[model samples]
Target: MSEADVTVIGAGVVGLAVAAALAARGRKVYILEKNEGIGRETSSRNSQVIHAGLYYPPGSLKARTCVEGNRLLYQLCARYGVPHRRLGKLVAATEAGEEPRLEALASNASASGVAGLRFLTSREVAVLEPRVRARLGLLVPDTGIVDVHRLMELYLWLARERGAELVCRTEAVGLEFTGAGYLVWVRDREGTYAFRSRVVVNSAGLRADRVAAMAGLDVDRLGYRLHYCKGHYFSVCPAKSRLVSRLVYPVPHPQGTGLGIHVTLDLGGRMRLGPDTLYVSEPEYGVGEERRHLFWEGARRFLPDLEPEDLSPEMAGIRPKLQGPGQPPRDFVIRHEADRGLPGFVNLIGIESPGLTASPAIARLVAGMLG
Candidate 1:
């Protein structure tokens, strides 16, 4: 049996960040990734937007961590030489009657400590985004985008440099308590292997509930219900791309799913719109070409001149949402000794949306729990 101070399941951004943070604290960390590569799942997919803590409810982990992690992530990206840009964002009230709702959003954001939200009038909005027609908009200067793949590589490199081991193509099948520690059963291309760890951190992304089940824990009872929401993205035409300099979003719906099918730019300045929420049964991580028309329709709401030919099917990602549509958003479930009696076992459940933004702070919180 291989022994380690800590074992992190799942090599997604959150798991990698946790491993890096734990390794930085002088813990021998082992990262077991079910896939052949890191972040091939939800991490690599989706809108690579560095959120500005705009829509999460006040005092929720999503709100706090996203607000805190946005600051930390910007600093880390700079310190580690990761490629990122704070291109800013605009939450616009496109409809005439939506201005008050936009104001409420600004107030909520202010309460969450999301700095630099400048309210723009209709003329000002037109000055900023010539193509956008909105009565009011809130410009978030701190909002940005990053090369998520490169950021994951940097985190893996740092963790490995600090003596952390990343075992790819390895899946944790089962786990059992061995009195002294936890014995984890992992299967790779070779076969099954048993490893013992003093601490186990379950950062499994979509399969977090399954991981918890294998560990002999009931996820539902622990306030975890995996409601998968799939989002699809569509590519934007180069000519119409420069229509906006910053991320443009419509005021989020009361459902908590970011509504506006706003435009987002890649690190290379290419633009894409979408990730319209669709509840799926299978929830496999792949884009449905059938959803292209849906994206076109959603895009037309904000970009009136958006044509169907302008949209090309891009990609899709699944969110491991713990709550259902119209339900209150749940805080990230980072249960250590507080909720679970088991020592040195932390289960991260329903870490969606601002999870990327909140990753660093979440890692620190995980480290503190482990200690």
Candidate 2:
């Protein structure tokens, strides 16, 4: 069996960040990725927005990490030449009566310690985004976009530089917790084997709950069972895409299932709208052309000029959510599992949206947990 000081299951952004953090702390690390490459799943499939810690409750992991990670990620991107933009974002109150909701969102963000938030009047918003129609706007300067591919690559490179090993196309099928450490049972094209480690971090994005179950945890009983929430994105035609230079969003969903179909620009400034929430039994990435109207209708509230034909099915991503449909928002579950008789097994579950934004902070948090 191969041996390492730490084994991180899954190679999504969070896993890579955790591996990098632990390795940087002088812990020998091994990253096992089931896919052919890192971040093939939700890591590479979403809007890639660096969230501003606006929506999560104050003092929650989502808020704390997002705010901290926002700063860290900006520093990393600038230092490493990662493709990114601090183009900012606009949370709009498109209708007259919606200004109260916009104010509430700002208040929540303020309580979460989000800085550089400014309220803009309709005239001010129009001055900044002529194409948008909103009664009021919250200009969040910390909100931006990043090239997730480049960010993940940087994390992997950092980990490898610190003497970490990445084994791709390998899946951790089962985990056996030894008295002192863990024996990670894994499989590849060849066969199955075990990798012994002093510490194991289950960072499996979509299958985190399953990985926890493998470690003999009662996932369902503990509320670690994940509900797959699929969201679809539609790219705006180039002609219409240039209408906005910043990310534009409507008041978020009342239940917090999604941020509402709004506008997000890539690093290259190509606009896309999407990610309406739909709970699914499995992770599926098929985008229906028929849903183009939904995107147009949703964004048309603020983007008055938008038409259905401007949208084209882009991609779909699934969030490993802790909350099912109509359920209240759930905070991220990051625990060492020592209380449950597994000393060094850290489980990161329900790490959906803001996860990418919170990765670096999550890494630091995990490293501290292990240490």
Candidate 3:
């Protein structure tokens, strides 16, 4: 059996950040990843946009961490040579009826403490994104794009440098209360084994709820059950990829199902539209070609120049959501479960969108909890 001060399940961005934070504070940390490598799941998928804490309710964990994470992420990018761009984003109301939603979004953002947000009129929107057709728009200057893979690499490097060990192709299959901490049952390519840790962090991304259940939590009773929401992205053909310089989004769904099918630019300046939310029983990453028209119509409301032929199925990702269809939006659930009789067991569930942006801050929060 192996042992450590902390055992982190899942080596996604958040898990890596936690490892870095804990190890930097001199904790003997070991990161156990189910995959052969890291971030092959939700972490590698989805839009890599660094959100400006918009679109979330005020005083929520999503709002607080995103606002703080936006700043810390930028600093981390500069200090660690991570590839990123603060190109900003625009949430536009393409129809007169949608103006109220735009206003609400702006108000929510401001209430959440996001600075540099400017409400843009149609003319201002035209100046920023000439191709987009909108009645009004909210310019969020704090939003940007980041090479998430690079950021994850830096986190791994920092953690390893601080004596955190990353054990890949290892899955934390079970957890047993060991009086003071947990006896984590792990399965690797060779076989299964157990590790003793004073603390266990459940950062299993899509499988976070399952990990919590392993520790005897009634996921359903506590509302920790995760619903998989798959989002598909369609890439713009190179000929029409230059339609937007910055991210362009439609007014988000009122229930927060998604931020609507909009435009997202990668670090390479290529544009992709999509991530229409479709709740699934299990995780899947198939992007159907038939969904191209759905994406085209959604983008066409803002990008008037978009054509159906210009879109092609690109990729897809599954978000571990706490809310189901027609349900109200759910905030991230990050708490030390000591009160639940699982001392030193931290549960990070329903950490989806903005999770990438909020990773570092979430890590610090986790560290503070353990401290």
Candidate 4:
């Protein structure tokens, strides 16, 4: 109804973090979310792991932000009383030839300032996880899990407390750049309304490219590819819970799809496996029960004792991948005025895996871009 100094176009984890950062900096921030609640998309459907900056290429934004944000996020969690724990992780090499690749991953992680990565021999891994038959492993003590929904709620609460407004179920349909500022047209149950804002941030996770097109920008011309890769998860039975104590991953594919149907434990101590990358022509979020067989097959690679009946359909998430499966992974595309020549506009595209982990750092970067 009123003009805002800044209008963030999405209320996911990254968007809420950006809004909170801006509000904390004394800006009148307004968050427009298309869903009824924040983080109901990729943010809420993720593995909820606090990555230790592993797997990303050296010197990339994903590597840098994830490494720094890992620390910042833990600090924020502690300060805000958000539920989280440093459960640690292991990049196991069950295959004989995969041992060197695991070592290389450890090297890359160390270069990224991820401390406490110990190279574990077969015997060491045995002591840590007796059931897992890993030839060698890299133990990452900093990786952990968090309550993502609670974190987003905390961000929204802090932002609201600082005079930020959250308009839920409001979808931005069109954008026009006026002489002074941009005009955003939003529609909902109440119909369409026009709002004005000097700065507009496009943090729309899946539809970021569409939002950019709505703003009269070419999606492909931005020199970034927005590929949607769907990942499915299956929950492990409670009886098999004792088989895994920490997160266990296989050597990541150089393509950065985060291969190896690894195991992840949630805050409630529930274990789930999967997130196998599958590229689709269109972005789809629905995970059905028919995929349980595929999940069980993938899970048996590292977890040999897993039974086909032990898995149940859990959830699915899509990553805004910048590169395809076989191609090399690209750095996060955070385009602002410096690159796009669009003043008071910021675009966050292709934010995948570590995006959740690097959310706070991404918010700070967005703030810096605004300034």
Candidate 5:
């Protein structure tokens, strides 16, 4: 890699989406992935849910991108023959105290222009999911799941077809800014190499801040701080997996990331209980069987029939957050930072939940920023 037009710094869904969009515009885009393959990090480790844009606050980047992404993703899947299912989700309230939260959620969804969200009584919940023992529920019909790997492949294929180059096993280690462009220092199996690009987009997911720092940007003052949050998942046994169809979620934790220990189904109809958030200092993805008891308590509220042994260790994924523990939830940080004295250097930080869903929209936003 000697000279390039635009270089994207990550190969996660958002990075791939950005590369594909720029390539489609005939930008001579190059995707720089540190890993041996694409989507191996945050992209592959998620619940793969196509979010309904209901959880995010109105007027935030996450809200706009997710609602728009939800529509665009469905269309992209249909157009590209990507595997997905709009199974819809049941946001359940197990107690009388949690009922108001249901009302608030529906109201909030309406505010975000997310249509087809309606309240579900206990009877309605029983009709939809007989095993769920919730007193009240909110049915978000647009919520769904996707084959994340297929989605990434589709993005990469489209990008490659449009003349984007994906160089795996090459990690961006340093950045040198020229008057017009950037010098990206990267290392691969062979040795260290450098590429010059007129434009550099840092869509590096968890390590986005580090990428920003390499460009001589002050991350702290730039508000590019990132904290790692880990979420563990458990797979339900086959017998119990068949019993659930729609995704079921408990009422959100007030000061938490929302969507507490919830149940998500894959395209194969396998049930997975997960993604309970725990702040960690590093990126660790080992699922602990010891969490089964805690998982049982949280899941058994809605899934009354789930037994202790029904849950098995599955996997874990970490979120790179701009907001730390006990802090107010922050919106997605898509900074052009020309004001920070770095033009053509965009930093996408704290892109967690809905990042997968908002990949396409985020890509469009980044391309627009570059232009």
Candidate 6:
């Protein structure tokens, strides 16, 4: 097989974005995906909300990339005519006890370079969302949703236009460092094959840790092990879809298991609630039918008008986590292992949440690292 200057594994949004960035720099980039198509997993099955750099710890990659990526994403969308909306978001504090978390989020957001956040009184929230009952609200003018498929399509198109080759259903099964470069052993419908590249980017999302291990990195020993945290979403019944115009969030779990069951509106104005976190033994994407009542109870905090039957199973996605239950939040691990005596190999693990928003920025950062 012909050698590539740079090869990226995993054709999810981050990998595709990384390819786009590398290709733009005139690198001979190639992408391989295990799935038959891009975004078959966590990329497409997500909240699809453009986070406003609000919930991450200060100085973390998630914070920095999300802040910058959010800005860059809007520009890319506009440039490529990608379908999206900066329709804004409202994170509400429905109970008095939750108001402290609101203050902390505002402070953290400001520290993370998020601008134009304004606290709202109950009356103001009532004016904006008549059905929402909250004692206080935080309006983030920058949060929005995009047609993610279109966004990925643009990235793939841009990469291809720049001479990057993307082959779906190609799985990288082995990685070994050599004098010439890194050898990537891959398999596809045709058969197993191998190629060499000066740089290898492991953006394999849920399987990122395994990819790292293929390069001789001791993931568990290095604390780079990935925990699969599953989150479920339930779309609101059409009768109640008009109940929200903005993304309405309850106070996030204090431990950051996942964002609480909150309301999100698609660009089409349909509402969905979801994403309670459950640590699973495997990478299961099945929505728990038994958890619908829990969704109703949690979302009913601010969405008081929701009936028990107002929600139904929508979808589920798994997060590749570095932090497990009750652990302090973990930052994304994106490092070129030069210090490990292996240069030009980058590992990205636990890139959940703001990953979609931060994808472009991440690509640029990778390009800069290679530079």
Off by over 4 Å in 5: none
1 or 6: which has the higher lDDT? 6
Off by over 4 Å in 1: 337-339
Q: What local lDDT score does residue 350 receive in model 1, on the 0 to 100 scale?
A: 95
Error of 4 at 174 (Å): 1.3
- TM-scores, all models, native as reference: 0.96, 0.99, 0.98, 0.96, 0.98, 0.98
Candidate 3 stretches greater than 4 Å from native: none
State candidate 5's TM-score. Answer: 0.98
**Tens digit of per-residue lDDT, candidate 2, span 1-371:** 46899999999999999999999999999999999999999999899999999999999999999999999999999999999999999999977777888899899999998999999999999999999999899999999899999999999999999999999999999999889798999999999988789999999999999999999999999999999999999999999988988999999857668999989999787999988989999888999998988888999999989888988999999999999889899999989899999999999999999999999999999999988
Q: Whole-model Cα lDDT per candidate?
A: 0.86, 0.93, 0.93, 0.87, 0.90, 0.91
- Which one wins on lDDT? 2
Which residues of candidate 2, in runs, are more than 4 Å off? none
Which residue pairs come into collision in candidate 5?
none
A best-first ranking of the candidates according to their lDDT comes to: 2, 3, 6, 5, 4, 1
Tens digits of lDDT, candidate 6, 1-371: 59999999999999999999999999999999998899898998888999999998879899999999999999999998998999899999988789999999999999999999999999999999999989999999999999999999999999999999998889999988996689899999999989899999999999999999999989889999988899899988898999888899987868668888888888888888878899998987788679989999998889899987888898898988899877887899989898997799998889999999999999999989889
Candidate number with the higher lDDT (2 or 4): 2
Candidate 2 has an lDDT of: 0.93
Which residue pairs overlap in candidate 4's backbone? none
- Output the lDDT of residue 81, model 4: 94
Worst window of 10 by summed lDDT in candidate 4: 333-342
Q: Quote model 4's TM-score.
A: 0.96
lDDT of 5 by residue, 67-119 (tens): 99999999999999999999999999998888987788788888988999878
